[model samples]
Target: MKFEEIDLSPDIMSGLADVNYTELTELQEEVLPAILEGKDALIKAEPGSDKIASFVIPALEMIDDREEQEGASVLVLTPNPDESQQIDELVWAMGYHAQIESASVDMDSDAEEQEEALKSNVQVISGNPGPLADITKKLRYVFRDVKLVVIDAADEMVKLGLQPKLKAILRRVLNDHQTVIYTEEMNEEVKELTKLYFEDAEIIGLEDSSHMLTEPPKVDGMLSHGYIYVPNRMKITTLMAHIEETPTDNCVIFTASKRGTDRLYRTLRKQNLKATSLHGKLSDEKRAQRFANFTNGDVQYLLVADIPAAEIDLQRVTQVINYDVPSNPDEYRYRADLVGSGKASRVVSLVSKQDRSDINELESSLKQAPKELELPEKVKQKLKERKKKKKNKKKSKNKKRHNNGRNKRKKKKKKDELELPRPSFDKLSGGRKGQAKKDQKSGVIGLIKELFS
Candidate 1:
């Protein structure tokens, strides 16, 4: 659809033309009209789908034209600082002609400055959910007139543990508001939110199949999936060996946990490998620096744990290795999709015995299992020795348990043999001489009768 066909304001049209945005993408064509109509919507959009423009343009169009408006009319919730910045810039460029005032709540910036900006009677506001939620609590009037709410990268927000904060901001804006959520697909988290808060929301681009995993993931055809079956203890060795053997222009190694990423990064650095790491613990400045280093060809290897998909650019990545297989099948597809498009890229996974269930899930999602890759000879030797040690440990434990059981049985048998009959013991304990003598006579009679028989 052409922008000229829509009944948008002349100012917005001029802004769009300035940016060379003439025709609407498929996602925009489907979502733009619904948002303009004040209907709640859940849109499924892949990366690079130009999904941001759909909501951002409509959000700009919906701002109350009056200059005396009290609070922000549009609230945009992003997953990270980068996305928030992007929204702020886009809103500025598109809302320029209309003199739309927008404020971004940045966590890394001076709090006083952001607070001061919020007090300027901004028409649009955007920020990460954490800062946004806190801002809403302090400045309750900021969202008092919210006519539209855009949850950009809804899945990423949930992945970053921002769901509660998102809920907090939504709860405060309790008035009749329009909600628009953009995600890769209709995940469980997004589905639950829509059912709970979004009334009869129109879900766009979602397949009728369950979880949208009925078909295989749409990854680059040139990319290959493979795994190296190694023992958990030898995973590090296997990864190092693979790295040494297969050189790449750029590589991304994903660990299952932050501690694992740290350990792997330290090990690689110890070996004098040109490597860096990315994780949730790093400061935003440090993270951005390291990311730039990798993307700018300054670094060859990047070890990451729990990085949002939007943060990583796959264009320069040539190889991807999973140091620890992820439990979620979606993670597998995400890693697979990280390979550069149209390049001979490949994704290798270090699969251990504990990752069997996760591998099965990936297979189900991919419609085929990852091909098995032979382990390096050195790694194989280490794995063999580790298995041998584990086997010996198991045997020792079983032997110790058997010895303990045998000793317990011996003690019980000895105690049983030493025990006396209850009636004889009772007669001997009695203080009456007559009773004792009668008991002795009965005992002697019984013995004499046994001997005669």
Candidate 2:
């Protein structure tokens, strides 16, 4: 359906037309009506489905447009800074009359300044949930008249421990207000919240059995899936070879841990690969700056820790490389969602022998297996030998350690048995103390006689 058919305001339609957005995508067609009617909704739509516009339009339509409204009428909570920034820009595009400001108190900005933004004729407050509780607790007066609250990417916020912030905001938003939750995945916590918060909310994604399982290459705008099976010893070499051979313009390489990012980033940089590291270690400012550099093509590659699902978006990211196979389907889904900008993108996962089963499970969920990309025979043989040698070395060290421990215990036992008892000087004789005094006097008289002789 066209956007105008849905009863959106002229200003909102103008903003939509400015961006050439005329018709609603399937996701919008599904949930926008309920949202616009002020009914609580739990929406599940894939990334890049342009679902934000669906809710943004409704939020704009609900603004009353009367100059008398006060405080933040709508509050939207995202999972990370990148998503917040993306949504903020989207809000500005549509919220032409909104006194929009950030409620991202836990970020780099001054808490007071962001608070000032929240209280200054604020109609919409968009930010992460990390600091929402503090703001809500300190400024309860401002949230009393809120009309709607949106928990965008709710599952991701739960993963990042931002539910406490939501709990804080919900306590003060005034009861019986509208709530809309948008997420790709729903777990027990989300369902529990659904039961606790809403009396009769409509669910969107689970209406059919066919939608339960997502097929790869179609689920999240990913065009192809390919995997290279290599041992740990040959991973770097294989990765470098693949990158050099493939003509991808920009890549986000995911490592399993912060330490892994450090090591991989250094190796890539040493090879003059124009790579930098990103993980939980970097401050918010540095992380933002580095990501901006990568997006602007100043940095060619990002060696990142297994980034949270919502925080891994870039405008022109052509490829996503899993330096190690992801541990769960959520991570695999997150990594796959990176490529939804209408341009085709590739997701390549490096699967070792141990990771084959994990890859199989992920494939099972996607209902599609990954095409195989082979490593060199020489590298495979070297990897086999190195693994065997490493295993033997560990056994030898364990044997030596056990023998040393046994010998130490045996020596301690033998020394204890060979020890003699020491005498006590306080017990002069076996009889009594007076007998020893008389014996001492006799000994002195004998010594005097010998001297006279």
lDDT of 1 by residue, 1-453 (tens): 899999899989888887889999988999999999988887888754287788889888887344555678888887767767777888888889988878788676667778888888788888888887787688774367888888887778767888888888788885678888888856667666656666567778875423332222465555677888886567788888988788789899998778988898889889887788898778989999998999888888999987744346556478899888877666677677778764457889888999878877877777546888998878877777878999999999999999999999999999998885555444465647757656666777867866887
Report the Cα lDDT for residue 444, model 1. 73
Q: Supply the TM-score for candidate 2.
A: 0.44
Writing each residue's lDDT as its tens digit, candidate 2 over 244-330 gives 767577888988899888888788889887877788778989989888888888878888884564465565478888888887665
lDDT of each: 0.78, 0.72
Error of 1 at 370 (Å): 34
For model 2 the local lDDT of residue 447 reads 72
Model 1, runs deviating above 4 Å: 47-49, 64-68, 139-142, 209-453
Per-model root-mean-square deviation over C-alphas: 17.8, 17.7
Query: Which parts of model 2 have CA positions greater than 4 angstroms off?
Result: 64-67, 97-108, 140-142, 207-453
The superposed Cα distance between candidate 1 and the true structure at residue 384, in angstroms, equals 40
